[model samples]
Target: MRYNKEDLIEWIIRERQPGGQMFERFTERARKVIVQAQEEARKLNQNYIGTEHLLLGLI
Candidate 1:
């Protein structure tokens, strides 16, 4: 599988939908950290950015 910017953006949008699923507001730095996690997942040939990637990005 391959990861790309467009796909990642779509995933992020889906993850942030209404109804209290995952609609928490994020700061600019938080958004950047999410993007970085996505990049790291892609670099490692993974399709999704899991907890480990997010933690690594935040650290």
Candidate 2:
């Protein structure tokens, strides 16, 4: 399976809708990094995120 930017963005939007409690405790900066990580994963054409993606997000 491959991932594109649109699909990843849609997934993020859907996950942020009401009833999503997973990120409730996360700081705004943390959330931004996660979104960036997803973008990194999409850029690599990956269906899932890895440590490299998170590192890139931090960078």
Candidate 3:
């Protein structure tokens, strides 16, 4: 897993962006974790702050 966005950004920064493919690798539960992580990274979308319900639903 990536430590921070700087790491993610540095890793993803490229001449041609084939993005969003990263998310495709996630299972439903794993995807939820990633979505929550991404929201926390942005400091936006407070809905992801309380994402346990998503975990419960997915599981």
Candidate 4:
């Protein structure tokens, strides 16, 4: 279940396609948050990114 950057971008596009430009904007924000979470996890010596991290970003 390894996800690359393009995979994430595609997922975001698909998830927000219905909302058009607004959804696109949201997706961009979400992606930034996800990246930040990944960086923070790395800083904490985490080997994998988990659902909890993603959930935290969403919140």
TM-scores of the candidates are 0.55, 0.64, 0.35, 0.42
- Candidate 3 error regions (>4 Å): 1-19, 44-59
List candidate 2 segments past 4 Å from native: 1-13, 16-21
Q: Candidate 4, after superposition: displacement of residue 36 in Å?
A: 0.8
RMSD of 1: 9.8
How high a TM-score does candidate 4 get?
0.42
lDDT of 3 by residue, 3-26 (tens): 897876776774222325666666
Q: Residues 1-59, candidate 2, lDDT per residue (tens digit)?
A: 88999999988987765334566688888877777888899898997869999899899
lDDT score at residue 52, model 2, on the 0-100 scale: 93
**lDDT of the candidates, in the order given:** 0.74, 0.80, 0.54, 0.66
User: Candidate 4: what lDDT?
Assistant: 0.66
Per residue, candidate 1 scores C-alpha lDDT tens digits across 1-59 of: 88999999988888754222352577667777787787788889998879988987897
lDDT of 4 by residue, 1-59 (tens): 88899988987887644334543556667766676666666777996668866666566
State the TM-score for model 1.
0.55
Total backbone collisions for each predicted model: 0, 0, 0, 0
In candidate 1, what residue range of length 10 has the lowest lDDT sum? 15-24
Clashes of 3: 0
